[model samples]
Target: MTAVEPRTPADPATTTELAPAAAPWWTTAVVYQVYPRSFADSDGDGIGDLGGVRAKLDHLAELGVDAIWLSPVYPSPQHDNGYDIRDYQDIDPVFGSLEEFDALLAEAHERGIKIVMDLVVNHTSDEHPWFVESRSSTDNPKRDWYWWRQPGAAGAEPNGWGSAFSGPAWTLDETTGEYYLHLFAKQQPDLNWENPEVRQAVYSMMNWWLDRGVDGFRMDVINFIAKQLDLVSGPAAASDEGSPMGAQIHDYLQEMHREVFAGRTGAHLTVGEMPGVSIDDAVLFTDAARAEVDMIFQFEHVSLDQGVHKFDPLPRNLVALKRSLARWQEGLAETGWNSLYLNNHDQPRLVSRFGNDTEFRYESATLWALVLHLHRGTPYIYQGEEIGMTNVRFEGIEDYRDIESLNHYREAVEQFDQSPASVLAGVHAMGRDNARTPMQWDASAHAGFTTGTPWIAANPNFPEINVAADRAAERSVFRFYQQLIALRHDDPVVALGDFELLEPEHEKLYAFTRTLDDRVLLVLANASDTPLTLQGEWVPDDISGAELLLGNYAGDGAAALRPWEARLYRL
Candidate 1:
């Protein structure tokens, strides 16, 4: 296959004059994320499948979501959950068949909800035929398909760079006497995008899916796909600007757009998960004229409380959080777009991480929902998030299911000389397993996620935090989400308004205004356990008799906001 040259996108900083005829359909849409392994199990096989997702479509429809982003369900060895894909075009036996997935697509389309598939092309499982052929011999025909290097001096690793999961990124194959690079787990070898054959093959696979009626793709670790061909050592290897990396990534994406999605119909959504991406780069990636992607998932706000290492978390800082999100809002105000989300499959539950999840669970959950939904972007709600799901507290490391958490525990305890108790404490606070637990549907065995044993245990608090109780309660987070979704659909200002962050330096209050033409929407929330009175300057001049469109509290309080109180007003 001959590769086509792509047209470069104009610089976003100077391209503000370029504008589209109208906003896209997704600006006002809300997406729901479904982690298939934990969502529901229709076959009672201790795992969720395509059938389970099809059965739960009504729940998503009732919640008023416009789309469902399903995490990877491709065939895999289960080394890194479903991300280490062995076959790109087939479904895993554990997750049902291709026919089952087709049924799901047709059913979701019937209800006016689009289905977005998780695209994990950055790496492939070691068991994949491409990788297996490449590793068979030293001079195999497909040896250049993946990054393989000879051992360094004294038979050490190719470089000193560490894997995202832990240990050196290069794994040695005894048979070939060469090392293959894997940014994540050793079971997942990174594909060499430098090879034109590799790039064309990936594009072919993507086009196959698009032709099959899938809506779009949520690309995983997309920024890391472009690598330094020199095989440089040290931390700088992950830097943004390089020969085949950084800015060059856009070229590959542009070519992919022309090849796979040039004439695609439907309101397809494309979001790239780009870590360590700066705002300027994000602007270029999301600019409409770029044709690279619709939006990118930036990690600035989520990394505010993270220490040097991800597991070593620091205390949350409200002031820093506000500043980070504000910067993104202003950066993309003119030329680009944003993807609003608090937590996803790779992180802990948002209610437990950023909100009080205990004494004020309902209050804090609803408050966060109100603040995030009203932002000028497409918001994504993870499964179990609408019902105020809390994090799980497993007693031991053995109870965990994520490969990252298990590897960190071993290294921290044995190599770093840390105590098992201390490592377990960190895992409890920031482990991926916290987000991988079975979804809490009702107060039954295994939270009604599975009739048989669950792949991982459900949160012990499911008895009170399950969907059944929230639907019946007078004040429920699920119902609050419904109202927010409806508001976005009914009001144009919520989606097209210009964002102006107010009181960004304030510690306990998160206030912002959305202005479109003559309409102004104000969102105020007390992100703390204690009550707070709005400072005089923070209160707008048109607040005398503003209509309260939505609020978490029962009755309108006079001046002070109650604990975790959030209100949306139209002035």
Candidate 2:
């Protein structure tokens, strides 16, 4: 692909150029997540690349998103789908070259859209130069860049901690005669932030990207930056092998803020993927004093139905779901910002999991939109989510691609002696492959993701549920999201107002009000299949003659809400 040079900085004299005015860009900004591998493919290499993403920037801008978060395009060995970065400053060959990445940044900014790269600093690929050299010999200059330890008295692992994906977290290196820590996969070695030189290296790399005009970073597994120094194993939440390393993580984030990401100016945003963190702990990481991250994506709501193991699936509970969301809303309201999202590259599609996508997919999808966006946070719309995409079903274990999903299947079938059919059933219910399917651009072969075979199969229902069809329909979920985003940006109260839950006791209904000075916004969603009635003292007097701003149902004014129906009202 031809390299597109970065546009020259705006001139002060010729075009009446001036410094861009300061605005709370992130407050009302609608971010669209692009899973680059499945988004688009320009080279017909059966994989999406940076040039493909650049070509799709106009499509994203037209979709009404204010920003784009490109998932893990950094240089990697494709282990864990680019989450294990080999080089923070370079793009992977499969994705594109650095020049192509520069072109993508220039094109996105020229389109009035900011781009946030995925920052995977918690760990680096074992193939990374730093890790390769660090693991070469104990006394090497880069040896302390990653956590390493001598074997226990019996020549076993130092602790009982297990890898998040599977097996032991400590991987033995015969060459160095020691075990190195890896929270996820053996190929992804955890960085040693305790080393000041390591922290400085990371900070320097971050500033390099920021100075290149990249808007911000969507930090990958950010809270894991700091691990317990003592290396003592604690009681496990579920299994006896895996220990929860929560305390030291937050402390490291505080230091990250002091040394790297404080007081950055306009358009510089940072959202951290901090799993297993309490609401109080999340507040500390996002507090203005810490200044570590602008917002944090909490997994409480997503993990409600997840079984004792991460891949195990259980029946969904509406009541528990309400409580989880309410906790985060109230917990972060006073202290920090919440990053609201239901589906991402790591989870199943929201339509299939949360709502009855078989019958009311579009309505439920729009209803979820109304529910999540109305909350106090910057909303992130995953690719193909606007059209109510559903999860895919695989025939065999060979059909799966995600390492975590495959490991879970092996554990359930081989280790636990479960049937193969039963294991696939569980995987069908909850697997990362559900989100890794190719983006459904249109009904063409491979969902128009590529002229040739795609790296992964596109969702089978692409023809019926796709961007082209939704963009043409006025009542489509796509348009509903567009309207919701516009309303949020146009109304200041919706963006920065105080959020108050209305009728917290309602089991199947979730309602909230956002009030700032004289402006009041009421959001209601029926989270069940049965129709629900709006009642009680929480309904404000101002909305007694409220206008129906948006809804999934079509009818006269103040119409009743159907099953899984949602509405937004403003007075």
Candidate 3:
């Protein structure tokens, strides 16, 4: 647990001699996300901890990732799997102690990897000290730290806002004779950013972590930092719950940057998860002027299939997915950088959801890598994604843990009047918990996760798709990802280049090119099961002699794409 200096080439200049960059650091790096519960567990506690993550530094280093974005490992009640942070500065005992976390940072840095901790600032667990005190009394100083409202006429709820999980967003506090706001679970109370002191406190906490050798942060729901002061009902969109102050969120983000992040070391990065933001709104957050975030991870493509039902469907159209990526690429090219991602803690596995995992799992996983990494954006690789992890099938509702997933199942079965079996099927299709399962390490008992019982069961496919097995195979998805990442780092065209969509009108194929100066990188992805040949006007003139850089197809370069095959070519 001792603080070890980074073993990678250290900065030649001293801290005092280092000049701060005009913009933050994340813009220039690739961040790999690690869901701690699934990442590793050194103590055999059935849950991944800091020590376990530290033990895997070699694995990450071999993969050639630049940074590690760990999901919240802070003190929490685990009501929402550490998203409900009870304390920001302390590591959750379930994950490990503060000393262990410090060791994780030191070890990760020694492997040439930066660590970006998940910053869940929008809300805190109901058990958080601040929330407990705030809820204790109406006159408490911390009472104003949270959003609390009085009862409306006839004691009806203040508004029709629904929580993201289910039920009313407002939870009545009998002790205070008022209702407090909870956008997700009642256990999580939304913080009142309108309070200047609260903002200052948050900034102080961020600086505290940064000073402790942490490189940066992957801000969770950062756009929700700002709320509408009026607390008016939000306009109905795909969901009834509107951000109370969705319009003013950016203003608060700007303030956050100016006060907390501005003029910090260039190595300090911040990637914001802003869910309902438009391209223009996204640009505002990442624009140099804003200084709030280096890049933004929007969910336009991820939510394509999530219709009126919360978690029960597949992508509606492959064309829509391509269009969404194109739109974001074009819109953010000049304004700011995009944080490209297909899999994360809150979504299902990419191979299973977008590619065919049942038949061509390895090829599909590699194809997904080629598709996302070739885009003109910094790519984020989720844990277990390189090895093609698939969705877990729960036998019944009792097997589920995610609040959102369980709530949807109840709504579908109890409220919507659907059969329990059908509801379970829908939950299996898109439950966020699918991504939350333990990371499959090996084929041993419990996926080699822990000697004791795990917090959640590991996917049964771990034996076939595991790190050890893939590491030995030259053509494994894990190795393919390494090559893909290396290409991004070595080729300037693949990194900071211009993106031009080729044959965007193709219904079953998505192809694009990245060009910078004279160098060009061409990428093609078969978004369907059937083979399709695409001829385009923008095909590189030198492509006649182009060499295959990377691909998911099984045979030689001439082999046609199976399902969800992705290819990258250098010309």
Which ranges of candidate 3 are over 4 A from the true structure? Answer: 1-28, 232-242, 534-542, 554-556, 559-563
TM-score of the candidate numbered 2? 0.92
TM-score winner: 1
Clashes of each: 0, 0, 1
TM, every model: 0.94, 0.92, 0.92
lDDT of each: 0.86, 0.79, 0.78
Model 1 C-alpha lDDT per residue in residues 8-34, reported as the tens digit of each score: 211112222222337787877788999
What's the true lDDT of residue 467 in model 2? 80
Give a tens-digit lDDT track for model 2, residues 148-220.
8888767777677788888888888999898888989999999888788988899889889888888888999
* Candidate 3 lDDT by residue in tens digits, 1-571: 1111222222212221222333233433467899888888899878888888888888888777788898999888888999999899898898889898888888877777888888998899999999999999999999999988887766656676788898887888999788888888999999988788888999899889988988778888887767765553322222444455466677777877887677776567788988788899878887876676888889889989876755668664777888899999999988888889998888888888887788777767887788888887789999988788899997878878888988878877888799898778778878888898888888898888888898888777788878888877766777777777666655556667788887767777778888877777788788776776544564556655777777776543443555677777777
Off by over 4 Å in 2: 1-23, 232-251, 262-264, 534-544, 557-559
Clashing residue pairs, candidate 1?
none
Model 1, residue 271: displacement in angstroms? 0.4
RMSD of each: 7.2, 5.5, 4.8
**lDDT, residue 467, candidate 3:** 82
For model 3, name the residue pairs that clash: 228-245
In lDDT terms, how accurate is model 2? Answer: 0.79
